[model samples]
Target: MKLRDELNNREGYQEIIEFYTSSINEYEQEIELLLEYEKKGIQKYSNPNLEIIKSTKEELRNAYYKILKSMYSKGDTIEGILAIYLKLISYFTETWKKSNGYVQMLEMLSIGIMLKIGDKDFKLLIEAVKKDDPQDLLIDTLISYRDENWKQLSGKLMWNKPYKALQEVIFLAKEDKNLSLERLHKYLKKEWFRGAVEIQTHKSKFNIHSGYWSFESGALVKILELDDATLKDQQYYPYDMVHYKE
Candidate 1:
């Protein structure tokens, strides 16, 4: 098969990564604007509506999808696409979870920012992302309706799978005295929320959950790493990681 054909045949993280890293150049301006807007406080785009933001996201998503389609069809390198996709996903995740005076907006933004899944979740979300499942149906309906109660809806929508995953780990830490509520809020602000915001455990199952928004992908649709090293190598360590005990 030709190179483009090969790329076309690929899917999930591999394909997404390929499109993102390779397409970063096209999105450089968008990245800069997003950054500037965040720094300036969206003063120019003042009444930030959920629909408008979702529309913008959809437009960009389609653009990337189209580019991937065209490129892969033409036999091109899928390299470099992943990085760009990761960055844009991060931006969207961060922007979506901010508090702009709306309650439901705040909740949906929070859960979506902290969305996760185990191995099964990774596969399911990845397929949905690829357009096979009705995830579009759920997230689209939520964004279209844009209600305050949608956060609960999100929990039901993801079937409380990833939510429980996060809640389980964090609750364990909280009860164990490894984290705080404010720190938990920090995790909610993330694009790829983890539990290591202020602490890390010694277990291999899950050592740390991050409270920062990842300028990378969300959706635990797949398990990436299964080791304490992820926490050990964290660039920023919270006090609970090694300083305290219950």
Candidate 2:
């Protein structure tokens, strides 16, 4: 659909615009407050116990989560919520550059996790990450351990795994100019992937290896110019370290 047609066809279009406008304004205002706090020498992790920092982070998190949940509960379509998510990501990217890299890394990863519950969300995130932190390299290197094996996250590739996988791909790309999807998957198998399956029942519909995982894995494949067949094949293994030979 044309942009105008999409806007015109969406129900409560004006309301959606108003919500985004208001939310953006509020988010900007909050960022300003955080900046002012920083100016006052209020470091996010100044305290020995980091109580103040933790509290502030929790508050920031709850507020964002509340808004996201509220939007989802109101039957806002994925596109609508995605609009807000991108805006938030934009703001967070700026905030990330200003704050300590590690703190913002964790924050962005958490937000990424929440937003990556669906295929659309994960797809959106890949675009945003490229724009905000190209190649997912910044956060990846900052939080990722270079020597860690992929199998460590075999069955538990949660919040940071996708980025880690992408980072691994970067290394793989350099090491093997002839890198292929099968080769990449072989590399992945050597590290952290234990595999399992979850039926798409309503209660477990959003579990890992669901739509988002496949979408994310696909994104990584595309970014790395690798085939996606191996990733698709790995989704069904109910055991760890599949076809291993030691």
Candidate 3:
């Protein structure tokens, strides 16, 4: 594995890695403490605050996701990245009961497909998503992966710019490979990072920066078997994961 040029030799890479590592450890310890409180039937004032446990788990998974990205930026092996991803998926499966948000669900499913996770893990991903409304085109697209059916629902997309742009890529993927590739290219170049506050500025105040990647774009390429020859070098497109075998 090679370090992503964007992150290679960049200042604060080690600090970012250390920050994520420490955050992951802190979240783990917090989960343990919460579990102990639950076991002992402790309460904060009158409320048991069990919801905090679930929220803490969400934070833990997020930390894992960041570490996975940091590992990639730091030139970690594929196996190492996959290991962290598996932990993320497992934790998500165990804790996540409903759709966190549209973007979050999309990113999770996309990364799962891009990684070519095992059938069991993939099914868990599907099950987690089954909690969302069936009318959602994103949910429909995600379910299509398991059913091996592609649904054309471009007419049903909402007017939200970023969401619509991403949904277009997935829908076009099944109809026209070339157009899908073009839309993906356009999304990566313009729409993808429109509201991404995390990486908007060149420098980070807390060393939380990690490589930017469009796992969903890679997932579309993997699911539809679209040739990404032209997209391989596009900024934010995770080309290596798209072509990763075994």
Off by over 4 Å in 2: 1-58, 61-81, 94-168, 174-180, 183-219, 233-246
* Most accurate candidate by TM-score: 3
Top candidate (lDDT):
3
Alpha-carbon error at 195 in model 3, in Å?
5.2
- For residue 51, give model 1's deviation from the true position in Å: 6.3
lDDT score for residue 105 of model 1: 28
Q: 155 in model 3: Cα distance from truth in Å?
A: 5.9
Q: For each candidate in turn, give its C-alpha RMSD to the true structure in angstroms.
A: 17.4, 13.2, 3.3
Order of candidate numbers by TM-score, starting with the best: 3, 2, 1
Q: How accurate is candidate 3 locally (lDDT)?
A: 0.70
Stretches of candidate 1 above 4 Å error? 1-42, 46-54, 78-246
> What would the TM-score be for candidate 2 when compared with the true structure?
0.33
RMSD of candidate 2 to the truth, in angstroms, is 13.2
**lDDT digits (tens) for residues 1-246 of candidate 3:** 456636434455556667878988887887788778788888643545577767777787777877787787766767788888888887776566443455556677877776777878888877776554435566566557755643533345433556577677777877887898888788888887774333543365556667777677777777677788988778778777766773
Q: What lDDT is reached at residue 27 by model 2? A: 50
Q: For candidate 2, give the lDDT of residue 125.
A: 35
